[model samples]
Target: MLSKSHLKALSFIREFIVHEGYAPTLSEIALGIGIRSKGVVHRYVQALAQEGVIELHAGRKRGITLPEPNKERDMTLPLAGRIAAGRPIEAIEDQVRVDLAAFFIGPGRFALQVCGDSMEEAGILDGDMVVVAQQEHAADGDIVVALIDNEEATLKYLRRNPQGDISLIPANSAMVPMVYAAERVRIQGVVVGQLRTYGKR
Candidate 1:
């Protein structure tokens, strides 16, 4: 965890680097955070460096640089290479994981390739990989991949019934929603983000 001032300084430094293409001077950072003291800003920067959240390049001016976050477990996901139709594919061991944090949040994330146009209206097209956050439950209207009766699975909007049933609603108006017993429906995961590729002309 970082202190409030430390976080503020990090934010300022990130925004400054993004817009200015370089790190800010301690004096500028002090002004950015309203500290009015370059010395205080230096100490904060030093603390951030000591915490391994940043680095201070020796013998260089405006050398403060943000370090990569020390999180590694969710940095990658198991890639099936090219697959997944109506069933969840088995994980391949000895496989290199492609960094997909760019697609979604949380550590329990996985990728699934779309095989149908049922979710096309929801902007999910065939061949797109949906990054899902692993969870057992989702709110109503959330697009989720639901395994019905521990066998057949479908991706659609989720809803409930007064009689304690689950409704799997598809985005395509040409398709009708399927209702099933709540006990038979298992939420595999909720859709968080998606990845798609375009062909070059």
Candidate 2:
């Protein structure tokens, strides 16, 4: 966790580096953070460096630099309003950040690359990466990754019949659902989110 002053200094340094194409000096950072003492600003900078949020280079005029952004975590994107999927609608600009970490990263969460079209009708296509929340159980209607007889694994919708039987349902109409004894099917995880890539792999 970072204090308010630390966060402010970090924000200023980031914005300054982005606009100026180089890191700011301690004096510049002091001016940006509305602080009068260089020593105080240096203490904040040292603290940020200790936290691994920024790096310092010895004997350089502009020594501070931010680390590269992580690709697999803590990513955010602008939510620039909605578009109609069925009909034409007016475009409106909206300023909002969609934090990808909140949706895909969490305790016991993992991702699996989809292999088949069993879930095509559910808008989950082959080759898509599905994020799963690992657990031993799931609701009756949840799409889940299941281990069958502890031998084969598959993705399907879970259904519990009144007779204590389980059904692994597929989204494609061309395929039939698999019925198994409740003891034969082990719920590995539940589908939480998905990712698809366009163009060359």
Candidate 3:
């Protein structure tokens, strides 16, 4: 079990890594938590390191290494969205950042913002940011983001019939089901968690 002070430090460190995409330095951690000295923060971080929660890579710039969320008490993870797979993953630029590493239980994760009413009945309306785990395959009835016809990308429920035909299921009855030969559809990510901003509708 971790002491209260250790837990507080861990929470602050986790927040920094989530929002900043990098671990905070001792000074930054100290200041963020209302402490005055980097030395104090270093001591707490050392204790966390000793507990095997985080690893410090001394002599390397930006040397903090955090274990996967599976190794920690926080089960959520940030579901990252489609990145230019050809380019590097960019920094998060949302107005308010969420630490979703605890929510993403998958081994891989990413996030995307919702943009349509097709899934509105599921309460995933426009402007909701959903965290999706990157996955190449899923079982029937999994909600997934898929690229269809190379021109349209949609969020839908994947249904695989016994005959092996695949259909994209929409929650609302008004929208017709889209059926395709299983070979043409590409799975992007599986929905793991949903986050709605306070004011964004």
Candidate 4:
């Protein structure tokens, strides 16, 4: 069994790779896990390599790599039970599996990590990953990734006025909406789902 430190190191490496699109160096790993000793970090890496949890490439500075996930395994979780968000309810067991792949994976679907709190009221916080469906057109009130002037991109609620102006509305009440000419805004994608990690990110 892997110790707590091993798990923490593994988790950090995974997150770093997902965010940066490459493996982190030993020093980066040490910094990420709050350890001061590169020797200790090297030992942890060697242990993980011995356990077949990661691969190490000799002569490479950033050689750590996670094994590929088994594609045949179903991406699902047990439904288990349901809980109320408001009123109290009786707990009941469920026998269903929630197929995450069905909901989040499809042609033209992609995910983007949120970077700001502009959509907090809509339950999309900073650091959350939003699954988006690629499309060029969106109806009014759809939360979408909008490209402005073919340059800057932002996530907001799409709104159209009779005057042919488009408004990019933020979920936060503290912020005002941005108005643009209809021709200046391009619809990139609509948000379909979202995911967030609970603990240390």
Candidate 5:
């Protein structure tokens, strides 16, 4: 239900928040959409806020934040604190809402919970939820979720040999690489972001 202008504004806001950790200013929004009037930009922003695409603060200049729409639209995930501070923790009864679309890049992206330490050297720890973008193919050295022999799924660095054979290299050196013929393996997606929560499950 969003117009082209409104969608453009949302796209700009998405990119700005991803890179800057805050919303763009009115003038910045204007420049992004080629609007000559700040008033016009403000109106567009207000419209977006009304649509539940963004949350607006009344008094602050950089007050726009992506709305955490739980059952409405967009993905919501728990942000359970930091990794540095650690302990055996239990899940809290109350949860904070965070819109995962703000952090993810492409459409059709999904998350998977990492199960083992096979990719620990790559900074992917067990219990980490990896955001993966669906794809049929991948470039060299890209970490990908791959289906092996049409049965097993695994996360590893994908390397294709000149002969077209595939090597699934585990980041943890202790784990040996897995080799398979190109015909036997299917690429499901590429790892885009790794999410982890500490002090809570």
Candidate 6:
């Protein structure tokens, strides 16, 4: 657990890095936090560094850097929810850590898990992990898990037919194509990585 002051400092540091693209100097941090003494900021920084929350670069214009955001096994963190296949699941406070590391192949990454056989043809199945790069849009032919009508999420190969109609293709031919307006689909993420369980039966 982190002290309230330390957490506040971390929040301030993250905001500064995001907006200013550099860690503020001790004096600047002190001013930002409305503290009178530079030593107080320095001590807080040192404490945060020791706690593995942030790092300081030696003799640089912007010395402070945020550690890569990683999930910790704790009860206070955000809980995950079920992926909607027919209708989007209502966002609720009940999910646990879904191991989002695989999705974050690089910066600005996120992840979600697969839930059904609607996409089995694509090798995505129930219990398989789906890593996705966070984005607002996807190119045609990309296998994406998308939100339809703001009610459900489903996985399919995205395509634009010759007639300029949008379709979600299931790799399994037995499964029919899902057609919808181009603007009706909301791409949550593109499937970039998958995890499978194996056992010789």
State which candidate has the highest TM-score.
1
Choose the strongest candidate by lDDT.
4
Clashing pairs in 2: none
Local accuracy of candidate 6 as per-residue lDDT tens digits, 7-107 = 77778888888898777788778778778898888889988876667888888856888777673422221223455433335433345654433113344
lDDT of every predicted structure (CA atoms): 0.75, 0.75, 0.70, 0.76, 0.75, 0.68
Determine which window of 10 residues in candidate 5 has minimal summed lDDT: 82-91
- Superposed by TM-score, candidate 4 places the C-alpha of residue 172 at a distance from the truth, in angstroms, of 0.1
Q: Candidates' TM-scores?
A: 0.63, 0.53, 0.52, 0.52, 0.59, 0.53
lDDT of 6 at 111: 50
The sequence of per-residue lDDT tens digits that candidate 1 reaches over residues 17-52 is 889998899889988989888888989998777656
Mind giving the per-residue lDDT tens digits that candidate 2 earns over 34-63? Answer: 999999889899988766779899999998
Worst 10 residues of 2 by lDDT: 82-91
The per-prediction tally of clashing pairs is 0, 0, 17, 0, 0, 8
What's the true lDDT of residue 100 in model 1?
67
lDDT of 2 at 16: 98
RMSD to the true structure for each prediction, in A, is: 6.7, 13.0, 12.5, 17.4, 10.2, 11.5
